[model samples]
Target: MKLLVFAHRLELGGTQINAIDLAAFLRDRRGVDVTVHATEGPALELLRARGLPFIPAPDVRLHPSPARIRALRDTVCRVRPDIIQAWDWWQGLEAYCGVHLPEGVPLVITDMMMHLTRAMPRGVPTTFGFEGLRRQAEAAGWSRTALLPPPVDTEANAPGASDGAALRRRLNVGGDAVLLVSVSRLSEYMKSESIKRTIEVVRELGDTLPLTYLIVGDGAAMPRIRETAGRANAALGREAISLAGAMTDPRPAYAAADIVLGMGGSSLRGLAFGKPVVVTGEAGFARLFSPETAEGFIETGMFGHGAGGADNAALSGPIRALARSPDLRTALGAFGREFVVANHGIEVVGDTLLRVCRAAVGYRPGRVALTADAARTAYFYLRERRFRVASRDAVERG
Candidate 1:
C-alpha cells in the first residue's frame, strides 16, 4: 500500500528520526511505497540525504492559513495515498486539515514521541505544545489516536555488540573514571534544570570516585549549562564535565558510557543499549518504558518529585552505587536490553504500526454494533442533540 507520512520537520529528534526509521523499515520489509512530506525546517535536507522520497509541504504550518491549507489539499489529491499518517500534533493537524481523501483512503494520527499531556503541564508554551494539537484533534472529530513509541535501532544500540572500551578510549575517557552520558537538547521543557541539579549533586559527591559527565546536544540553554558546568567543575576541583555539542550519530557516545543520565528519548535509547536509565519528568508518560505493562525485565524510575524535574536524593545513591558496581550495571542493563528488544525494537514497533494502519484503512465503525448499554448511551446523547449543540456552539465561538 502507498503511505504518505507527514511531519513538521525531519530533524534528529526522537519523533522525526522515528518517522524516518519507520518509513525505511516499511519500504524495506513490507515493500510499501512511502513518501515523506515536511511542512518546514532543515529535516528535509536530511531526508533527501537518506534517499527517501520527500515533498516540500508549503501549506503545512504551525498555525492556520487557509490558502496554504488549500495548496496542501491539492497536493494530497495528486498523491492519492492509501494511508496518510501524521507523525505528531502539528503534522497531525496539517494532515487533518490538508488531506481531502477518497472514500477508501484512511487518515491515521500518532503520538509517537513526546506526550503533550506531560510537556504542557510543565510550562512549555502552548504554541509549540502538544496541548494545542490535542485541542485541534478534538475539534476535528478524529476518534482514533494511536500511541507509537519511538523505535530504537536495536542492531546498533545493543550493548557488548560494540567495543565500549575502544569507544571510551577514543573519547579520551580514562579507564578508572565512571562515565555518565546524556544526549538531548538543553531545553527547560526537556528538564535541563534537572540535569544541572544532577551535575551539582554529582560534584558534591566529590573526587573519591572519578566521574565524567558528557552532555551530547546543544539548544537554547547551552550557554547557561556551560556556565553552570564551569562553576560545578571549580567547586569539584576537577573538570568532570564535557558538553559535546550535538552529533548526528550518538552511537559512539552511547557505547562509551558506563551509566546514562537520560532525559526521556535519550534514556529510551540508553535502555535499548542495556544501560540503567534514570528519568525525571511528568511521571505517567515521560518514562522510557512503562514499568507497569512492560514485560517484567526493564527497570526505570519515574520521578514524581515535581513536574519536569528529577528526584535528586533518590537518584544520587543509585548513580554512586551503579558507578561503583559494574556487576550491578551489567545485570540491570541486561534486563533493560531484553525488555527493549522484546518491545521497542524497530521490527516490533513497525509491525504494530503496520497493523494499526491496516485496521484504520479497513475500519467500518458503523458495522460494529455496540452492546445495549453503550447503544442506550449513544441514543440518549443523540436524542438530546448534545453533539449538534456543542458543534454549533464551537462554530459560533470560532
Candidate 2:
C-alpha cells in the first residue's frame, strides 16, 4: 500500500526522527511505498541520507494553516495514498480538513506526549507512546486507540556503534572518570529544571568521586545550563560538567557514557547503547532504571512526576549509587539493552504500524461528525491563542 506520512516538523526531536526512520523501514523492509511530508529542518538531512521519498511542506506559522491545508490537499491528490499517518494532533486535524472521504483514504494520528488534549478530534484511529495515556484516552471516549511506544534502531545505537574513545578525548574526560551523559533538546519546558539539578548534583558528587557529566544538545535553555555548569566548575575548580552543542548524530555521546541521564526516546537510545539509564522528569523526579522500576516506566513512557517541585537533591542518591558500583552498572546496562531490543526495536514497531495501517484503510467517519470536529478544533485553538496572549501580557506587566 502507498503511504503518505505527515511530520509536524523536520527538527531534531523524537517524533520527527521516529517518523523518518519508520518511513524508511516500511519502504525498504516492508515493501510499502512511503513518502514523508514535512517542512525543511535538520531532520530533512536524515531523510535524504536514508534515501526516502520526500515532499517539502510549506512553513507553518499558525495551526490549521490555509497554506498547509492547500499543500496537503494537492499532495494527497498527487500521491493518492491508501492511508495518511500524521505525527501529532495538529497535523491530523490538518489532514482531516484537507482530505475528503470520497478519496477512500483513512487517517491515523500518533501522539507521543505525556498528555492528550480534549481538542483532538474523536472517532479517528490514534496511537500513544504510553499505556497510561492510551487508557486515559479510552476513558475520555476516544476510539481505535493503540499503545505504540517510540522505536529505537538497536543496530544503529548498539554498544560500540560509534567512537567512544574519540568523544572522551574531545570532552577531555579521562579514562578513569565515570562519565554521565544526557542527550536532550535543553528546552525550558519539561527539561531545563532536571538538567540544572543534575549539574548541581554532579558538582557535589565530584568532591568524592571521579566523575564528568556531559550534556549534549542546545536550545532555549542553553544560557541557563551554561551559567549553572560554569558555577559548578568554578566551585570544584575543575570541569565536572561540560556542555556539547547539538549534533545531528548523538551516538558517540551515548557510547561514551558510563551512565545516561535522560527521558523518553533518549533514555531508550541510551539503553540501546548498553548503558545504565537514570530517567529524569519534571518536578524534581529522578529514578534509576532497574527491574524494580521498569514496570512503571513502561506504563508511563520513561518519565515521572515528583510530589514537591524542582528539588535539587532528587537525583543525587540514585546517581551516586550507580557511580560507586561498576558491577551494578554493568548488570543494569545489560538488562536495559535487552529490554529495548525485545520491546522497542525498530522492526518490532514497524510490524505494529503495518497492522494499524491495514486496519485503518478505507475507513471514513460520518460527514456530520467531521464537520463538528472542525468547528470544535477551531474554537479550542482560538481560546488557547487568547489565553497565551493574556499570559504574555501579564508577564510583561509584572
Candidate 3:
C-alpha cells in the first residue's frame, strides 16, 4: 500500500521520531511504499540517512495555515496515497483539511500525549500511545480508537550500538562516577520541574557519592534548567551537572550512561540500550523499572503522574540505590533490554500500524462531519492563541 506519513515536525522529539522510524520499517521490511512529509529541522539528517522519499512541508507561523493546507493538498494530489497517517492531532486536522472530499483517502491519527483534545474528528481512526488513553477515548464515545505504543528501534539503540568511550572521555567523566543521563526536549509543560528536581537530587547526593547528571536536549526551558544546574554545580563545588545541549542521535550518551532518568520515548530508548532506567514523570514521579513496575508502565505509557507536587526525595531514592550497587544495576539493565525488545520493538509496532491502516482503508467521513470537525478545531486554535497572547501580555506588564 502507498502511504503518506505526516510528521508534526522533523525535530528531535518522540512522536516525530516514532513516525519516521515506522515509515522506514514499513518501507524496508513490510514493502509498503511510504513517503514522509514534514518541516525540516535537525532530524532532517536522520531522515535522509534512512533514505525514505521526502516531501518538504510548508513552514508553520501559525496553526492551520492556509499555505500549509495548500501544500498538503498539492502533495496529496501528486502522491495519491491510499492512506495519510498524521503523527499528532494538529497534523491530523491539517491532513483532514487538505484531503479533497472526493478523494476518499482515510486519515489516521497517532497521538502520543497523555491527554486527549476534543478538537480531533471522531470519524477518523485514531491510535493513542497508551492503553489508559485508548480506553479514555472509547469512554468518550470516539468512533474508532486503538492503542499503538511508541516504538523503539532496538537494533539502533541496543548496547554497543555506538562507542561510549569517546563520549565519556569528551565529557570528562571519571571511571568511578555514576553517569546519569536524561535525553528530553527540555520543555516546560511536563519536563522542566522534574528536570530541576533531578538536578537537586544529584547535588544532594554528590557530597557522599560520585555522581554526574548529564542533560541532553534544548528548548524554552533551557534558561531555567541552566540556572538550576548552575546552582547545583555551585553547591557541589564541581561540575556534577553537565549539559550536552542536543543531538539528532543520542546513542553515544545512552551507551555511556550508568543509569538513565527520563520519561516517554527517552525512557524506552534507555531500556533499548540495556541501561537501567529510573522513569521520571510530572509532579515528582520516579520509579525503577522491574518486573513489578513493568505492568503499570505498559498500561499507562512510560510516564507517571503524581497528585501532590515535586519531591526531590522520591527521585533520589532510586538513583542512590543504583549508585550503591553495580550488581543490581547490571541485572535490571538486562531485564530492561529484554522487556523493550519483546514489547516495543519497531517491527512489532509497524505490523500493528499496518493492521490499523488495512482496517481504516476505504472508509470516508461525511461532508457535514468533516466541516464540523474543522470548525471545532479552528475555534480551539483561536482560543489557544488568544490565551498565549494574554499570558505574554501579563508577563510583560509584570
Candidate 4:
C-alpha cells in the first residue's frame, strides 16, 4: 500500500526523527511505499542528504492558508495514497484542511505529545504516546486510538564512548572534566526549564566540580539558550558550558556524556546509549530514571515533574548525584538501556505501529464522535497535576 506522511518541520526533535524512522520501517519491512512531505526544515535537509524521498512543501501553517492548502490537497490527490498519516498536530490539521480523502483512504494521526487529541477531528484514528493518552482519548469518545512509544535502534545506540574523547576535545572541554549532555530541542515548552536550570547548576557547582555542560540540538530558544551558555562560560573564563548546536547525528553527543539529562525522547535516547538519564520537563521537574521510579515514568508518559517546578535548587540533586557516583550512574544506565531495548526498541515499537496502521487501513470511525475541542489542553493541565503528585509520592514513599 502507498502511504503518505506529513510533518510541519524537521528539527531533529524525537517526534520528527521517529516519523522518519517510522516511514523508513514501513517502506523497508512492511513493504509499503512511503513519501514524506514537510513544510521545509533541517529534517528535510537531513532526508535529502541521506537520499530519502522527502518532499518539501512551502509555507505550511496552522492558522489556515488557501494556497498552501490547495498545494497540499493537490499533492495528496497526486499521490493517491492508500493511507495518509500526520505525525503531529499541525500536520494533522493540514491533513484535514488540505484535502478530503476518497473513501477507505484512511487518515492516521500520531498524537505523540498528548496535547493534540482535542485538536484532531472526530473519527480520526490517533496513535497516542502512552496508555494514559489512549484512555484519555477513549473517554473523549474517540473510537480508534493505539499506544506506541517512539522507537530507538538499541544496537546502533549500544553503550561505549569510542567517540567521547574526540567530541570532548572538539568542544574544548577539559580532559579531566565530567560531562553532562542533553540532546533536546533547547526551548521552554519543549524542555520545560530543565535545560536552563541544569546550566545554572553547573555554574553554581562552580570551579570545584570540574564539570562541562554540553547542550545539543536547536529550536526557537536557541539564541537565548546559546546566549546564556556563552555568558556563563565568559563569566567563568572557561568552556564550562558548550552549545554544540544541533547535529545531523546526535549519537556522538550521546556517546560523549558521563551523564545524560533531558525529558521525553531525549531521555529515551540517552537510555538507549546506556547513559543514566535524569528526566525533567516543562515544570522544574527532574528525577533519575531508577528502577523505583521507572514504573511511574512509564505510566506517566516517560516525562518528569520537578519538585520545585522550575527551581534549580530542586533540580540539582539528580544531576549532582549522578555526577558524583560513577557506580550509581553505571547501574541506572544499565537499567535504562535494558528497559528501552526490552520495551521500546525499533523492532518492538515499530511493529506495534505497523500493526496499528494495518488495522487502521481496514476500519473506519463513527461520524457522531466527539468534537475536536479543548479536551487535550484540559487533559494536559490535569496530567501535569497528576505527574506532580506522582513525583511527590515517589519521593515521600522512598
Candidate 5:
C-alpha cells in the first residue's frame, strides 16, 4: 500500500517520533510505500536523517484556505496513496478540509492527545493512543475511535549495557555519579511541569548525593529550563545539571542513565531501553511504573489526569531507591522492557493500524459530509484557539 504520513510538525517530540517510527514500520515490514509530509517543526534535521521521502509544508492554518487545500490535493494526486495517516488533529483537519480525499483512500487520524483533541474532525476515523481517550471519545458519541497503543522500535531499544559511559564522559560527569536522564520536549504545557520540578529535586539532593541530571529535547519552556540549569549550577558552584538540548537519537541517554524520568512516549522509550522509568505527568502524576502500576499505566497511556490524577508520591525517594540498588533497577527495567515488547512494539501497532485502514477504506465520505465537517472544524478551531490561549496564559500566571 502507498501511504502518506501527515505530521503536525517535524519536531523532536513524541508525536513526531511516533509518526516516524510507524512510517518506518510500514515501509520496512508491511510492504508499504510511505511518504512523510509535515508543517513547521525544529526536527528537520531528524527528518533529513530518516532518508524517507518528504514534503515540507507551511504550518497549517487552523482555517485552511483554498490554496492550502490545493497543496494537499496536489500532494495526494502525486502520491496516489491507498491510505493517508494523519498524526494529530490539525493534520486531519487540513486533509479533510483543504483537499479532496480520494474516494477509496482512507484518512486515518491518530489522536495523540486525547483530551486536548476536543474538536477532532468528525467522520474521520481516529486512532486513540490510550484507552482513556478511546473511552472518552466513545462516551462523547464518537464511534470511530480505536485504541492504537504506543509503539517503540524494539531492536533499537533492546536491552543494553552502559554504552552511555562515553556520553557520561562527554558530559564531564564522574563515572560513579548516578545519572538521571529525561528525553522529552521541554515544554510546560505538555510536559507536566516535571522538568522544572526535577531541577529543584536535583538541587535539593545536590550536596547530599552525588548525581547528574541530563535533559534532552527542546521547546518553548527551554529558556526557562536553561535559566534554571544555570542558576542551579551557579548556586551549587558546579555542573550539577546539564541540558543536552535535542538529539535525534535518545538511546544513548537511556543506556547511560541510572533511571529515566518522563511521561507518555518518552517513558515508554526508556522502558524499551530496559531502563527504570518514573512516569510523570500533569496534576500530581508522578510514580514509577512497577508491576503494581503496570496495568493502570498501560491503560491510561502512562498519564493520570483530572480526578483520576496521580498518587502525588515524592519522586526523589523512588529515584534514590533506584539509584542505590542496581538490582532493583535491573528488575524494574526488565519488567518495563517486557511490558513494551509484548504490547507496544512496532509489529503489533503497525498491524493494528493497517487493519483499521482496510476497514476504513470502504466508507466513502460525501461532499455534504466533508463540507459540514470543514465548517464545524473551522468554527471550533477559531473559538478553541482563543480560549486555549487565554487558558494557557491564565495557567502560566498562576
Candidate 6:
C-alpha cells in the first residue's frame, strides 16, 4: 500500500524518530510503498542515511498560508497515497489540508510522545497528552481517532548487568554516590528545571551521599543550564554535575544510570532501559505508562516555580529511596519495561498504525467494521487494484 507520512521537522526528538523508524520498518518489513514529507530540520539527513524517500514541504508556521496549503495539496495530488499519516499536531493540520482521497483515503493522526491537555479535544483518536483534548476532538466531528502510543526498541534499551560498576567508574562516581542522569534537550523548559532541581536535591540530601548528575542533549538553554549547573555545584560545595551534550544513541547513558530523570521521549527511553524514571509536564504525559503502573514513579511537580532554590524537597525522598534499594528500583524498572514492550514496542505500534492507515484508506462508514487485520488486507488489495484473483496461484501458494 502507498503511504505518506508528514511531520513538522525531522528533529532529534521522539516524534521524528518514531516517524523515521515507522517508515523504515514498513518499507523493509511490510514492503509498503512509503514517502516521508518533512517540513524542516536535519532529521531529513537521518532519513536519507537510511535510504528512505522524502519530500520537503512548504513551511506553515503559526498561521496557515494559502500558497503553502496549495503546494501541499498539489504534492498530495501527485502522490495519491492510500493513507496520509501525521506525526504531530502541525502535521495533522497539514494532512487535513493536503490530502483529498475520494471517500476512502484515511487520515490517521499520531500524538508523538507528549501530552497537551489544552491542545487535544475529546474523541479525537490520540495516544498520550490530554484526555480533555481527546474529548474536544470527538466533539469537533472527527470520525475516527485512536490512541497509538510511541514505539521503542525494547531490546536495544535493555540494561546490562555490568553497566553499573563500569559506568560509575567512568563517571568517577564514588561507592556512596547517587548518580542522577537526565537525557533531554537543555533548552526545553521542563528538562532545564528538572536538572537544576535534581542538583539542589542532591545538595539538600547533604554530603553523606556523594552525587554525580549527568545532563545529556543540547539546545538553546545550554548556556543557561551550564550557569545553573555551576551555581548548583558551588552551592553544593563540589563539582557535582556534568553536561555531555547530545549523543545519537542515549541507551548507554540510560543503562549506566542509577536513576533517569526527564519527561516525554527521554522518559520512554529510560523505561525501555528498565531504569527508574521521573517525568514532568502535562502534554503527552499520560502516555508515559499505563494508568495502573504510573502511580509511584510519575509525579506532578512544577519546574522553575520556587524561589530560594530548586524544589528537591518534593522528589528528594523518592530519589534517595530508589537509590538505597536495589529491589525497588528493579521492580519499578521491570514494570516500566513490561508496559512499554506491550504497548509501545515497534512491532506492536507498527501493526496498530498499519491498521489505522488501512482503515483510513478503505473507510466506508456505513459498511460493516472489519477486524483491523482484515481491513488492512482489503485496503492493500484496493490500493493495488487487484480485482482479479488467480485460482492457480492462490492454490499453489496455499
- In terms of TM-score, the best-performing candidate is 2
Give the per-residue lDDT of model 4 (tens digit) for 90-136.
Answer: 56655655663323457787877745436455466788887776788
Error of 4 at 145 (Å): 1.2
Model 6 per-residue lDDT at 382: 52
Report the number of clashing residue pairs per model: 0, 0, 0, 7, 1, 27
Q: Which is the winner by TM-score between candidate 1 and candidate 4?
A: 4
Task: Kindly report which residue pairs in candidate 1 clash with one another.
Answer: none
Pairs with backbone N, CA or C atoms under 3 Å apart (clashes), candidate 2: none
Candidate 5's TM-score:
0.88
Candidate 3 residue pairs in clash (backbone atoms < 3 Å): none
User: Considering TM-score, which of the candidate structures 3 and 4 is the better prediction for this target?
Assistant: 3
How are the candidates ranked when ordered by TM-score, highest leading?
Answer: 2, 3, 5, 4, 1, 6
Q: What is the lDDT of residue 50 in candidate 2?
A: 96
Scanning candidate 3 in windows of ten residues, the lowest lDDT window is: 389-398
**Could you estimate the TM-score for every candidate?**
0.76, 0.93, 0.92, 0.86, 0.88, 0.76
lDDT ranking from best candidate downward: 2, 3, 5, 4, 6, 1
lDDT tens digits, residue span 142-181, model 1: 3454434457778867776567687677668898888888
Candidate 6 per-residue lDDT, tens place, 12-46, comes to 65667778887888888788999888766656767
What C-alpha lDDT does candidate 1 achieve relative to the native structure? 0.60
Q: In candidate 4, list every pair of residues with a backbone clash.
A: 192-282, 284-306, 284-309, 284-310, 285-305, 285-306, 286-306
RMSD value for candidate 1: 8.9
Question: How accurate locally, in lDDT, is each candidate?
Answer: 0.60, 0.83, 0.83, 0.71, 0.75, 0.61
Superior candidate under lDDT, 3 versus 4: 3
Expressed as tens digits, the lDDT of each residue in 1-398 for candidate 3 is: 99999876676777768888999999999999998888888888888999999999977655556677788888888898899998766677678766734456688888876777666666789998888988988898678898898899999999989998789999899899899999988777777777888899998899999999999998889999999999999989999999989888899999999999988889999999999999977788888998889999988888886764655777899999999999999999999999999888998888999999988886767778867766766686666552221110010000
Clash tally for model 4: 7
